[model samples]
Target: MSHYDVAVIGSGPAGTMAAYHLAKKGISVVILEKEMLPRYKTCGGGLVYRGRRRMPFDIESVVEREFKQINLYFTGDDKVLTSLRDVPVISMVMRDKFDKLLVEKAKGQGTEVKEGHKLTGITFGAISTLHTNQGDFQAKFIVAADGALSPTAKLAGWKETRKLIPALEYEVEVNAEDFARLSSEVRFDMDSVPHGYAWSFPKKNHLSLGIASTRRKKIDLKIYYKKYLEKLGIKEIIGEKAHGYQIPITPRTDGFHRNNVFLIGDAAGFADAVTAEGISNSLWSGELVAEAIFESGLNPEKAGRLYQQKLEKDLLPELHTSQTAARWFYGYRIIRNMLLKRYGDFAMSLMTDLYIGDRSYPKNLMKTIKGKIMEIKNPLM
Candidate 1:
């Protein structure tokens, strides 16, 4: 069987980033993907500004639309709050094109990308063997970036379930006029996407809309989404078909590594609990794991520990902190509106940074709390 220094399963952000970095380090690497190139994925396709930094270069060429504002719709549309940022802080993208771009970048970096190849089974030995349709291959190290229901994680015997939030999303072609009005702001409807939120992200000639939630288990998403569209005064559906996927609301903290295998991204449950955004986290984790492996001589346990330590110290703590704050957020409308009105653009930008993995909400929350405490201590002054 053919052997490589590293084999990565999945071609999503995590796998692509891992392959790219490993290849850049002069390690032989191969990335296996189950889908054809540029295949559509179920996503809201909103990328916040700070998270965009993980990419080596600007991805504006692949961006579908850019926006400078965020509109928050609370309990009632009458009490809407808006925030505007001077610079474009968000962009709407088509995942098919976006993911394909990164995968191509990996290829350009000399990482072998095998498309349309599904990982069937993995055999563990002195060198782990990955069974794929093209053929069987062996590797000294394996990176499982295969998403939430990862087969690689299972093969590695690292199984940890998480609290999952169901999400239904769609990208639709709309009137140019509507698209123009939508150009600089992302619309959020809290009423319809209860427990989660419904979002409308504008593209050049289309609109991306979707709803998600953890509480609405067993509820009919299509029916709920149709009702949501009605409330928005949208009478028609256009563009691509609606698709649904699960977002792991609570990430697994078990440290995903066993034998010669390592897990990153959704497979490792690194998606942020509040926004369900995983792209940047995936890339960050992938890079860290690759670094750990390279430094540790591919020792699974040491690499896993180092990866987890770095994650907890650098990232997961913030997510865990956000998880607590997100609970307080969905509880009532009054507090939410107050925060929107008081914080305004700053809050929205902060959240954008948080979602994209640039800033930690928990860290900011403490600062806010500290500021308030100091204010109370010197009230008269």
Candidate 2:
């Protein structure tokens, strides 16, 4: 078996980021991926500024559009916010291009990335042995950066907090002028979606339109999305190409590490429950775990424990708070309206913070609640 100091399973943003961090620190690491670089990944392609901040290299090469305006719509409630920020708050990207770009960057940093190697099994008794279709490899430490349906987590006997949110997305080409209009702004149409919402994010010359819901049992996502498109007066789809994927709403919040193995990103249940936005969280958590490992002086077991504790203290409380808030806002139109009206841009800024797993919300909660209460007291003042 080939030996290494670290083995990372998967090559998505989380895995690639972890490899980049470790390799930058001069650690021997290898990344195993089932598909080739820049493969198609079904995503909404919305990356907040926080996610962009975590990248080690410049990502301007892949950013299709910079978003300055965020429009939130509600059906039963009259809450709407059209705040334009001076700084670009969001960016649109194509995951196929974005994921591949990062992997190349990691390789440039001396990371060994092996594509077309599917992880079949893993034995974690003494030194960890990763069984893959390519061959068997052993490592002193393993980082499970594989996504939601992670084979690494399963093989390592990690229990995950589970809730699946299915999303259906369509990438349709549009006229350059129309695309330009979309690129300058992003819309979240809540009226068109009851339990979930419909989003329109512009990417270069294409419009990434999607609709999602998180009902317990699986329903027909296509039907819901088609109705959504029709409601928007999109009579004919310009591009036939489209994709879909699952979002784990209930993430592994309790803990993510076991012994010498650690899980990151969606595999570790680090996704935001309210928006299902996970890119920033994945990058942050990946970097956090890498720092913990380095500071541990390469002691895998101690690093794993410290990483778990810090993750819980630093991230889980906000996730729990957001999840609770999501359930409240989805049902109570009044609360949603009150929040948008009172908090306005400040509230949205806080949302950006929470999306990236910022734990400072406890200090901001009283202000949010006070502003919301004022809005509720007077509809228009």
Alpha-carbon TM-score of each model against the true structure? 0.89, 0.90
Q: What lDDT does each candidate get?
A: 0.76, 0.78
Residue-level lDDT tens digits of model 2 in 1-381: 788888999888898898899899998899999997768888888988778876778999999888766777665556665656555667888999999998998898899988999999887855788898989998888999989899888888776567777778888876655555566668887746567888888877778888877555666777877776665556545565777778876667456777578888888877777787888888888888888888788887789877877777766676666677667566666666656665667766666554333424463554656666876788695
**Every candidate's CA RMSD:** 3.0, 2.9
* Residue 148 local lDDT, model 1: 78
CA lDDT of 170 in candidate 2? 88
Poorest 10 consecutive residues of model 2 by lDDT?
A: 354-363
Q: Which stretches of candidate 1 lie over 4 Å from their true place?
A: 238-240, 332-346, 355-358, 364-381
Pull out the clashing pairs in model 1. Answer: none
Error of 1 at 322 (Å): 1.6
